[model samples]
Target: MFAENKLTEDFGDIRNFLLSEREKTLSEAEWRFRMRGYGYNLKRVDTGYEVARMTTQQVIGTLDL
Candidate 1:
């Protein structure tokens, strides 16, 4: 199933489910912050998924952590 909500830009309440369930679920705000801060985010590729650097568009592979 496709989730249309994920496409929205609203960074929902930080003190709600996101903050409380970070260990189980990664919120949009947290991922965006970490991705931009580290210059990378998980990207979907033809083969699968990868950790790509935004500025250079380089696929740096996946990370388990």
Candidate 2:
């Protein structure tokens, strides 16, 4: 659920934000399970959660984009 034409730089910042907040925002197990659903296995180190990239496509063909 991101806006169109949002720069890759902006996305990178968002990922950084999530990674920085994982522990403060979610329990370790909760964060791990959530990330694992998207195929990211997180390890608890000095950082909260490592960011993983997933390429998702918009289904605009049926929405008349």
Per-residue lDDT for 21-57 in model 1, tens only?
Answer: 3354366556545555545455545764455556787
Candidate 2: segments with Cα more than 4 A from true spot:
1-26, 51-65
Name the candidate that leads on TM-score.
1
**All models: lDDT?**
0.44, 0.44
lDDT of 1 at 17: 22
How would you encode candidate 2's per-residue C-alpha lDDT over 1-65 as one tens digit per residue?
Answer: 23222444354554553455454555768765765554344544453434444444221111010
Clashes of each: 0, 0
lDDT of 1: 0.44
- TM-score for each prediction? 0.38, 0.37
Error of 2 at 43 (Å): 0.7
